[model samples]
Target chain A: MTTDTYQAVQASNINKRSTRWAEFLIQSGLGLCALVSIITTIAIIIILGKEGFSFFQHVSPAEFFLGTRWVPLLEPQSFGVLPLVWGTLLVTFGAAVIAIPIGLASAIYLSEYASDRVRSIVKPILELLAGIPTVVYGFFALTFITPLLKGIFPDIQVFNALSGAIVVGIMVLPMIATLSDNALSAVPQTLRQGAYALGATSYEVTTQVVVPAGLSGVMASFLLAISRAIGETMAVTLAAGATPNISLTFFESIQTMTAYIVQISLGDAPAGGIAYQTLFVVAGLLFVITLILNVLSQKILMRYQEVYD
Target chain B: MSTPNKPAFQLDYGDLKRRHRKAKIFANFCATITWMGVALLAVLLAQVSIDGFKWLDWQFISSFPSRFPAKAGIASALVGTLWLISLIAIISIPIGVATALYLEEFNSKNRLNRLIELNISNLAGVPSIVYGIIGLAVFVRQLGLERSLLSGALTMSLLILPIIIIASREAIKTVPMSIRHAAFALGATRWQTTWAHVLPAASPGILTGVILALSRAIGETAPLIMIGGLTYVAFFPEGPMDSFTALPIQIFNWVARPQQEFHELAAGAIIVLLAVLLLMNAAAIVIRHKAEKKFK
Candidate 1:
């Protein structure tokens, strides 16, 4: 063969090789990104697990799980998960109580009643709330919302669960509304028409028919909102008063699992100390809770695929 | 689930009248609250503006934090924020976009690929603070990067990676498959077609996704704080390894201070953050509008 033909063949071969290399790198890069995500999760679990296990070695699992006290770093290391859990529940419950009604009502109105112009304006504004830093919300809750709450409830603690709950509820409201609106919008217009044709008013049709149809999405949104509330740290740290007390009253000071983690991290919790261990253990538990809720939402999405699509 | 077999053939006069009244009241109540939701946003904005506007002069923008509010400005913080965001975008966008492209165009129905996809989706919901821990351990301690802009940027990139990947994947998926087929029929290689034709078509969408991702990153404080982002920097960041302060961390620090004046500075920082966020979002909107027009 001539040198020219050989050069052409060589060029073609080089091009083919480069193409294959490019394909491999691209595919592998995707796999790597995905791997990074999984590795991050696994690393969290592993780190938290080892530290948490060590924590339990010092304090019995039964005491950690069942005991109603939590004062690890003090003179006596009383490691009880109950107070923290209770505080978490109180704030989360408060948040949910505030968020559910307002978010759902707004979502219902936006999806069912609002015009296009209203939606275009309202959705972005709601998203702006979501976009605000939790720290800023913390400031808002501490400076503005707490004082406002104090005016109404004289006995309320200056650093109380109510303000945190209220701010958290407001913080996650946009998520709930946005998700619920998407869910409601996914319900076929035909379904609404069918209900209306049966002489059902818009209200009856929306509450009875559409709400049920969008139930899974609404449920998923609720789970998402709750997880957001549970995982929230800065806001609770600032507003909820990092006091890990066992109290159910909304007006009392409390600390969540996340707040505790931030509290210890911000302080001088030494490496390998029990106080440090508590952070990992609580983080592990928080991770599991949020992960479980997330998995459930994904399952709901898959199961409701046919209904929505 | 039994469907109602019979419509109320005779609209019961008294029952219908009572139901209509209740429905009207409920619907109107919902409408009022939806309007309330919008108004809440307005109130928040108004409060931020009223508190922050006085402090937002040119010198204030250029000064560092001082004991006196008048002498303090966010010049260093603003520059540090710009640097962090720029680094984050540069590092993550190509990786994110490439990942999305691979998932959309190359990956087959294999278990590993599916597992990866599932993991990405799950990662999207992981709290930002968790990513902070991961960064501290993996990037800072293990890799010995220290608490610097690079580590912070890496942490943030991880936090928003799933978002960028998802958005980019959605964008790439929107590209018509027929375009690929047509290119292939004309003897274009997969790389050629993807690079020359598919990517350009998907550019606006991918750009919009990146813009949104940056918008979220700009507002994020939790992960950065966890990664030990400097809250008070007198000078702008010189390199990736240098300690840096960004808008959120600065705002957090100022807000945490007891002084009422510092609180005003926090609000001022928020206004700046909000302005940047709004601009990014607006740009994304414009990109989408342009894409729609181009496609039309």
Candidate 2:
């Protein structure tokens, strides 16, 4: 070969090597990005676990779980987490009572009754509702919902679980409606037709056939919505009073696990003190609660998901 | 016609009529409940708008927080929000998109890949405040970033990273496999094919996801509150290391005060926050529509 051809071959070899190097670099870069999420999960678990373990060193597990008081700042610093847990459950239950019926009904209507135009309009509106900040909902709860409730029942306090529950219910409504609507719509058209052919009324068909067939999806939506309600912070912090009372009454003031965390964080709790450690302990409990709920919901969603060709 | 006769069993026409009527009423009731939800949304928007418009002026946007409610503005919070969002976008988008690409294109169905997928889904559901604790322990304390804008942004990026990855994966999945085949047939490497063809095709959908995630990040107060976002910053943050306040935190502070005037200011700040969220959502919707049309 001539010298010019030999030089060209060498340049071609160099080009191939550079391309291979670029490919390797890009692949590894992408792999590292994927690893970031795993690293984050590990970091969260380690940090929370380490701090929470330290907290257990100071307080016994039984007292933290079974005690009814949560005054970590005052003298005699009782660390009964039951009050906060009860409060969280009360608000969550209230939210569920308010949200479930309306959300399910909305999902039913959207899936079965709505025209295409109506679905397009109403669906986006629900998305808009979901996008509204929880802080705004908190404001609305304080200014609108609480006063409205007070008008109906004069015994209601200015800051009560009912108002917080109602507002949170509203916040979680979109999630339930959207998810359940997808579930409902996912049922095969042939199933609905089969019911109709058997002289089933539209309502009968929906309630008896469609909903049962899509039960897992609807249940998954409910679980996800419940999880959302449990994890919600700002709305509850504002509307539910900061006093950690273990009351079951809807009209009473209560402090949820999230609200307690917020109160301590905003306050002048010295770092590494009991007051600060309680933050992690309660947060750990909150994390466990939500994580279990989320994992359970994911399991239901995956296991019972109906497939159609 | 004469051959028509009643069946062996009675039809019970009255019972049938009653059942039909009940069904009709129940259907109407469901529709009414759905509309009630829409009405609630309208009432919420109206109340906030009415309370907030008076305070939403150029002066309010330009000035800083003051002891007097009437004079107070969201300038610092707004700037802080902008800074935090920009930093989050800078940090999260590339990582999220790359992770999405790896999951969709590089990885095959395996135990590790399935675990990664499960991890991402679980991360998406983790409470935002839990993310704050992580930020506090790791970024703020361990890394010594303090309660600064950088720390807050890093925390938020983690919170929303899962959401972005999920959305990006969805977008990537929409790109047909034939496109990949064509690229391969043309002697393109996997990375080159994904980078040049697949990404361009999926860009609009990915853009939608980014905007939606940013909208979520902007309204987040809990994690930021956990990371010690200042509620009373009077001046804009000069750098990522400086302390800052965000729109939601400022609103939360103002609303918590007992004064009615501060509540009004809170409403005003909410309007500003809502407007930003609305704009971002609208952009996402528009882009999604365009993407749908192009792909179709």
Candidate 3:
């Protein structure tokens, strides 16, 4: 071969190597971007573990888990986290009670009964509800819902569990409605027609054919919505008063786990103090419960998706 | 028509009637619930508007918070939100989009990819306050960013990254695979194809997602509170390192107070917040509508 041709061939080989190198660089760069999320997850766990473990050094597991009356910032400070957990559950249960039937009904109406125009309008309105800030909901709870509740029950506290539950329920409603609608709609149209042909009424078709077919999705939505209610902070904090009560009374002031986090956060708890440490412990518990619910919901959702798709 | 006589089987009129009635009642029940939901939304809007309409004046818009409710305004809160949002947008968009690109276009479902996907989902499920906790520990204390706008923005960016990545991935997926094939059939490289063809095609959908994510960040007070961004800042954020207060934080503080006037101020701030949210949502919806229309 000529020397010039040989040099040209070498240059082409060099060019191809550079191109491969460039591709590698680009892909790794994007991969690094994806790594940021993993890094975030690791960071969350480490921080929660690092600071959260210190809270345990002061308060025993039995006291933190089994004990009642959480008064971490008082004269005789107690570290029992059960009151906060109970309050969280009380609000979550109340919110679930408010959200489930109504949200499911709306889902049924939208997916099975409503006209397309109605669906279009109602869906956006529901999205509007979802888009409204939790802070705004907190404001609404304090200013509107509590006063409204107080009218009927004259002895209700200014910050009670009922208004918090109602608002949180409202917050989670759209999730249930939308998710269940998707689940119900994913059931084949032919199944509905078959049910109709078999002398099933629309109600029968919806309850038996549609809902059963989409049971997992509906379940997942419920789980996820409830999980959301568990994590809801501002609304619960504002509506439910900071007095950590062990009882499940809707009329009384109560503090939730989330509310306690905010309470400690808003206070002048020094970072290394037991008061601040309690914040992490409570947050760690909140994280675990929510993570479990979330994982279960996703598992259910994945199963449903696999079945449908 | 003459063959429609009851020849095959006997029809139970009473049972059919009962069933029809039950169906009608159930349908009506669901309808009532839906209408009630719509009505509740209307009531919420009306209540806020009524309470805040008189309070929302020029003075309320331009001043800062005060011990006296009459002197408190949304100016600092508004500026802080702007700074936070702008910073969050800048920090999150590139990382989110790049991650989405990696997941959607650049890789197969390898172990690392699977881990990333799982991590993102779990992160998405993590509560906002938990993100705030992480922010406080990692950003505020560890990195010594303190209670600054940058810390708040970074915290929120982490909180919303999963959302942005998921949405962006969905958008990128909608860009037809054939587009990639066509680019590769030519001399274009993978990066070139994604950058030139795929990104533009997916830009509108990506934009809608970005706007919605940003709107979510706007209203979040929990994580910001955790990171100490809920301070009673009287001045606007001058830089990324400045301590700031967001609209929701301000509204939260006011609503937390016992005074009636502060509650009214909270109501007014809610109005501003809702208006901003509505605008961002409208922009997102319009973009989506236009994109859908282009296909039709």
Candidate 4:
């Protein structure tokens, strides 16, 4: 009887041990999987920094960041980067102007006024627009928007910033609209009723009460849209010509930082070459700028959520 | 109803009429702009159909890229996109789901968990081209994967990981705590409870998210270009390590050409790309609306 009891106890211990082992293995396995994102972030910084530092060793930061000209691929190659930065700002702000007001209005309509059927139809259609690839937008800019712009401005170049800005605006409009809609709808229903009780019309209630309460989210959406505009590559690359001019007119051909990266990517810049290193440096700058904007947007959005909750 | 010489809250019919008129005008304004957006989308689709329909045929789908516009097809690009997407889904989903599981089930509130969550949001905001830079340095050059399908797939996989993980976690979070508690009460280990109950309950939502993320990867262009997927690949990629071209790259090449016929070719390829995207989205909707109702 003692011997039987000892054997049974041994078997139970073995069973318990393997089950515990399996549970431990699964938990750590998941933890390892989660680490991949951390690794990606580290890889981005290390690779960009190493390559960017290599480029900075040859070129001064002042010249790279503050110079006026940016012809990095030609004779008398210059790397001022000012022109590309200027080009990006012009296109990005231009898109902001187009997307913001319309996106806000659409959000108000969808959240405060639309019938359920209308909301159902409009939301999916907006999503479908959002899902279209950037390259297709690029094509539309080249074929449709550029021509339309040229018809109005006789002196406009074939590859003008105007078309690029317009298409990028269209590309980001859905995002702004959707995010702002969520924020607007999240406002307590009692606020709207209070405004109505005070003898306000539907438009007044929406504008005065709903919009103000959802302002944080709207602002966050704007920041996120701006961040996306800055990083947008393909549509601007195809629509705006590769001429890195320091001009603001939508009529002139301008090249963005993203387009410059795309241009180099298409060429056979030997790996480890200075030209190749320039890509990483520019990307690093782009990454940092967008990262700051995104983090700010997220913080604002979270704080806004906390206020409601 | 007020005493003489005393100011009272008076309803001015004229001002009220003006305000109501203004409200009506503004409402019409919003409706017009919203419809205008829909109209713009319609124009885009119609324009693509007009430009592409004549060029799209059986031959266009079957033949590979060529100097002649009529002879050119998306045979290689179609195949390459299929290969990249399948590989990306395989590589990203398990890790993304596991990461979600770890965050939601194993450890809910901790410094490390918060860091992981923050890291993912930042990664999502990192521009796709920035991801391309990393892909070029690590996958193509450092790992010596070259400009192969594997490099492109890995790059796209990293690009979409944040999306998938975020979606998966949101899904997992919705699977009521009672489900887990019941499984535990039945003498199930944490892994068994998670595997048998939590994952099944979340699968519909997770599947929808996965399909949407995969569709996004399919339409991406700049990252693939960075990894040299823009090279002229005349033949179908034979393996993961074989060099390839994708639909967006092919369309970009065609759009860059100064010829009208090539522009039409780009439109034709876009039609194919959009069709694939539409299919994926429809599937997501079916899962979200039909299959997910049970969970609701």
Candidate 3 or 1, higher TM-score? 3
Docking class of 3: medium
The residue ranges of model 2 lying beyond 4 angstroms of the native Cα positions read A1-15, B1-14
lDDT of 1 at A155: 90
> What are the per-residue Cα lDDT tens digits for candidate 2 across B116-185?
8989999998888888878887898889999999999999999999999999999999999999997675
For residues A32-121, write the lDDT of model 4, one tens digit per residue. Answer: 999999999999999999999999998999999999999787889899989999999989989999999999989888998899999999
Q: Give the per-residue lDDT digits (tens) of candidate 1, residues A129-177.
A: 7877788788788778888998999899988999989889989999999
DockQ for the candidates, in order: 0.44, 0.46, 0.50, 0.49
> Model 1 reaches what TM-score against the true structure?
0.93
TM-score of 3: 0.95
Per-model fnat list: 0.41, 0.64, 0.75, 0.69
Locate the minimum summed-lDDT window of 10 residues in model 3 chain A. Answer: A6-15
Pairs with steric clashes in candidate 4: none
**Superposed model 1: Cα runs more than 4 Å off:** A1-18, A304-309, B1-14
Q: What's the candidate order when arranged by decreasing DockQ? A: 3, 4, 2, 1
lDDT, candidate 3, at B240: 94
**C-alpha RMSD for every candidate:** 3.5, 4.9, 5.0, 4.8
lDDT of 4 at A174: 93
Error of 1 at A55 (Å): 2.7
